[model samples]
Target: MTGGERRPVASRLAIRFAIILALALLPAGVIAFIKTDALESEVEARNEAALMGATVQAAMAETGLIRRVRGMVASLSHLTPTVINDPAACSELMRGVAEEEPTASLVAFVPVSGVMTCSSAGRTYAFSGNPLFEKVVRLREPGFVVNPRGPVSGTSVLGISHPVLGAAGDFMGYVVVSLSHNALNELRLDTFDSTHGSTAAPVEFWTFDRDGTLLTSNLDLAAAAKRVPASRPLAEFVGTGSTVVQDTSRDGQKMSYAIVPIVPGDLYLMSAFRRELTDVGGGLSAYMPTLLMWLIGLVAAGLAAEFLVTRHVRTLNRAIVSFARGDRRLQAIDLDNAPVELQELASAYTAMTESITRSEAELEDSVHQKEVLLREVHHRVKNNLQLISSIMNIQLRSAESAEAKTLLRNLQERIMSLATVHRGLYQTSGLADVRARELIPDILRQITSISSGPEKPFVTETDIDDLRLVPDQAIPLSLLLAEALTNAMKHAGATRDRPGKLRVRLKRSGGSEAILQVSNSRPDVSMRARIPASSTGIGTQLIMAFVQQLGGRTDSGEDDAEYHMRVTFPVSPLVTAENRERNEASSDKLGNDPV
Candidate 1:
């Protein structure tokens, strides 16, 4: 009848909820995993393709650079001898050429007689010990040569040898086009700005000749040429057509390159460009759209799952609430129209309710039969105890000696206390338990009535209402309180010489314990100390045994010439509710006060 009671329909709903959650989450998790793997693979393939394409673009750019440098040298040869020989006039002319083509490292003229001169910067020298220079001087006509250390004093330049003819058409000397091949470094795309204005990762460029001269580079030209892995065959690559060479550095792996037969006859133009294929947009902003899409998808999927789960929960909740309110006729909503597992749940619920009504009727009939049997047993026990108490009272009155009469009287009290509890239980709804608060007062009133306390003003006070304790707690509690009260009445009497008041109080302590306090205005010090000049009292022994059996504690003290006896014990609602209720009802019938 309490709110905490569970129904059969609730169990069915729990099963339904578990099934629905599994159905929703399992499929979503599988789909998400598959999508994640697919996206990662696609991105990797795209990255690889982009890198390879960038490498090919870099190689073609190098070949174009070499051709452009060759054209610049050809146009310079048309000047007259006066302009070529005059240092001041030639310096101005070569300076103009240097400004026009910034990639040209140097522009100078070399004579067939081995005199080397820088026509732009105005430094002059002759090739003496250099083997590359000797090779250039022996050539009789226009040719280009790789001179590691040429007729120029310090820097190495690619020598373009052409015959300088006199008026008679005889070769006077060879006019040489000495161009610093280091200018090939300008082809490096690493220095170029990207559209995003972010500089790309730095890359180095270096071109080395057969004699270990760095012909061109964005790095330290001379130092980088010396550091080239000497094992790589630079001469073989130049003898061949345009070649792509792969190399590596601390920054990244790269392609070293050369465009061979660069200027005909003796010259080869080697151009090196670092091939750095990296993401142009290396930041989160580059993938914002993709991340945004993923986040949107995640939120949408979560909301969809929540909507589906909440919808099913609402359907199940309605069924549970109806069952809790005892509406057995209410039908559960079908979830099969909702989700996969919820649909299965609906089928299960329908099947369960189909049989619940019949099962509930059978259970109710069984409970009613058991209750009838219990009530009959309680009625029989009450009758037998009453008969025994009556026989004890009759026997006590017939006893001849004073000691025998006292023993019989004590025996009668004990028997009557137990019978009183049984009598209360027989009248209660559930006969398994007696309410002690009701039983104790009835036993006391019966004792007081025969003991001449009709006008003694015996007061009964209780702080508990509707709380029940089982037969185990109620029986001992009833007998104990009855004995304590009986002693109080016998000693604190309104006899011819003395009169006193009796107080009986029962309450729940801290909502966890049952307490009974009986105080009487009996002033006899000998009785208070229980140190009689006589034999042991039955009241003391009986009260001690009852307290011990009930797992309770007893305290006795005197206040204002009144003897107070208190008994406190634990109560378990699970074991005691029915009996405590019945006994309290009987106590109400027997007492002058209500609590």
Candidate 2:
């Protein structure tokens, strides 16, 4: 497998075990989550109850204060007209009523003309445009109204009015009691302190009139207003019974509000408590125990796999890797203490390695025998060719005519060239191909020895690159080189005036081709001119035949002061036994085909 595709055995086993563990514990996790949700609901319910209780307690305190105010107003309504028409006596009576109720800011009697005639502050006031007077006059009923600034008290107040009637039951005027907003807020705080104590969560309370006019709050009026939900106005909760609702406040804090009526349609106490219970973040904590257990189980599984299985598998892997790296010496895998399956696998691997080693040894021996036989055949052939050359040399020495002697010597040189090829084959380690670097120099030495003499010595230069050729091409190439060298040496004769020079080069031309060049210095141009221009001679014909056998082309010409011969050919690929067998099979099939 590629490196990216491979994973550690321990990690893979750990992941699988983790999946199994999760499935096994799925029900328990679900149960814990359900329990957590139920617990959250219980907390929210309890908080709601506490909030409502606190609101109702504060509302009761407010209701008691309003009732006291009404009682005081009722007592004043029975006042004798003799004292009521006297402004000083009426003011004295109202001041005594205010003293009796510490929270009352004003006790006033306004006549039917909507003007206050008697007051606790002993001030006359016009109430014609006052909403409290207008409502009391029109409805002629007991009612409540909130004024930011009362004309009599000169402070924020809640006006509680009770309509009065004459002896004839005709509308006379109204007795209105104004309670200070700050005093009412202090009364509510006293109730909250007694009921909740210091340990209770902070709560804000706002009292609203039936007309939605904010009268008093335990906190700052503006801040307490922000505690109320923007979607629900205070008037919406005025006539409703005690209720609890969950909503976000204007300041974006989640809150639970308890709306409890002090007087069903006149006043409401709205207590806003921050939703600490419902806001509990329990999602992760609910699953933490299960997740922690899963992690522990996964780690244990990974360790177990590493210790019990992967360690043994890694040992086996090391042995296999060593064998593949060509270490023939067999190394034993110690897996006896491993699991039964792993032991059996190791046994099978050992047996397979043993078989492979034996096969390799036998194959090596067979290859050695084949190489020896091939060398013997080439050696015998070379000996026979040398014997034939020896015979031709003796014939040349005893020839009767000059032409016959020249023909015999040329034939001897050709036979000796074949011997040189066989000698290179037998001496080389590889029997299938010849090394041009070693063989070409040997062949050139043999040709020079036979053709050159001490009196007519020619300087020869050779540049050859190491190349390999099969026997099919090597034999013809050797003969071609021999003929070309012999012809060049004959024409390039050394004299006292100028020495003859012969240059030969063989090298790779491009990617898959080779070039062979042989050039000689032309000291006497007249002598080369005397030679026949037509290439119909034995040497020329033999060179052409060798070039054709090698599947190449040749070029020959005189350039400047030298005669040059160049041969270019494609290098044939080395053929292995498999390729040779395939080629033979194809040839047989083609031969059997109908023309």
Candidate 3:
């Protein structure tokens, strides 16, 4: 397989793998989810408490500013009807007092007649009808309001005022002071770093009068007020005690706010903070150990399935497939390393494989021994036939009669044909088949050497195909071909003055049959026949019998001046190869050598 290719698994195996994963990870996932939910609740609680503390701190800072303003305004002992009767004297006295007050933007004296009499900030234009002065006049005490732009050069300030008394302690005018916004902003806390200041989400501080009037804030008061729906009053958001609330801003951004009253039944302070997930102690990372364990558990389950389940299953499948295809040489699967659940199965498979291998080894050994015996038997048979042929050759040399010599030579050729079949059996790896093309060449060469004179060197031509045949059919086929070649050479004798041609051909005639033909060009046709008797020799009769025994047919005839023989036979392995070789000791002009 290439890197881009992946083996396909059966649907059943895929389903099994999925089931294992769900079993391993489902519980862990549920537990992790539960723990995560609990952690979120705790984090929200911490945020609520932290926001409440911050709002209280900021509310106390507002209280300090208001208290300082009221204290300074109330301690103005020089502010009496006598001192204020002279407008020039009162203005000069208020200017010295304002100079001594670093926390206030201005100090002024206003008459009860709803007009500014004389005051600091050079000259008061109008402030008598201001809520701060009116509240102090009505209650006969000091009062404060976060009205930074009231009755003075427009600036952010907390307004504080105190009512003055006549000698009869009757209602008179009030002395008012403006508290500086910058002075309140300079207050520091240990919780917020001094150098870097508050790194928390910016808090917007809002202080409201008792009448629920929107006074002033550290933020753009207009924008903050716009975030509140017009249907809801700002006082509704600023109840009595410190309370943290969350809502959406006008722009749909989520917001958290803490409201606290600085003065019990009067002024109130509210701190608004933006809520963000990052502000929850950096989200999930706050509990690193728990999150890490959750991830590790998931990974471990996957690894267990990969190594102990999926990998081992694939290994077992590979071994089984190899064995089914007749290969039993694979090494045993390691049961020791297998999971406890699969160890028994692995061990059983290993035993079965070993048993199969042992049985196959024994069977192969027995077959090998039998093959050796059969080959040796063929070898001995070949040697014995050669010995018999050699003895017949010696007998023919001594025979005086032509007939006896002819008989001896015929017998010797037959022996040699049988010997050739056995020789082929021993020579090739397969004991059952002999190669006809290979055997035919050897037989023709020997017959030609026996019949040819030094003057009549007969030429042999062969066009035989290589074909395999069982020994039973091959032995008879060899004898038939030898007879054909011997007959052609014997009758078509060429002398010193004549040369001869022989042609042999073997080819597949059809899908189930093969044809063999041999023809020769003889130097003399005036002998007037096929042989001493034309096709009547013992060799021809034996040829006929061999062809019949192999369930085939033969045809022979003379065409022009050449003698021809042809055989057609089946290609069944039980009835195998065929070959024909002709030696013409003649130079007679035939139409063609029919090969």
TM-score versus the correct structure, for each prediction = 0.44, 0.60, 0.44
What are the lDDT scores of the predictions, listed in order? 0.60, 0.78, 0.69
Any residue pairs clashing in model 2, and if so which? none
lDDT for each residue of candidate 2 in 26-143, tens digit (9 for 90 to 100): 7877787677678767755665676777776756676678778867777777773447678888888888888899898888888899777688888778888777677778978877
Residue 213 lDDT (model 2): 71
Could you give the C-alpha RMSD of every candidate to the true structure, in order shown?
13.2, 8.8, 15.0
Instruction: List, residue by residue over 437-483, the lDDT tens digit for candidate 1.
Output: 57766877765554454455454444444556677777887888778
The predicted structure with the larger TM-score, 1 or 3, is 3
Ranking by lDDT: 2, 3, 1
For TM-score, the strongest prediction is 2
- What lDDT is obtained when candidate 3 is compared to the true structure? 0.69
Separately for all candidates shown, the number of backbone clashes (residues 3 or more apart, or on different chains) is 12, 0, 5
Q: Of models 2 and 3, which has the larger TM-score?
A: 2
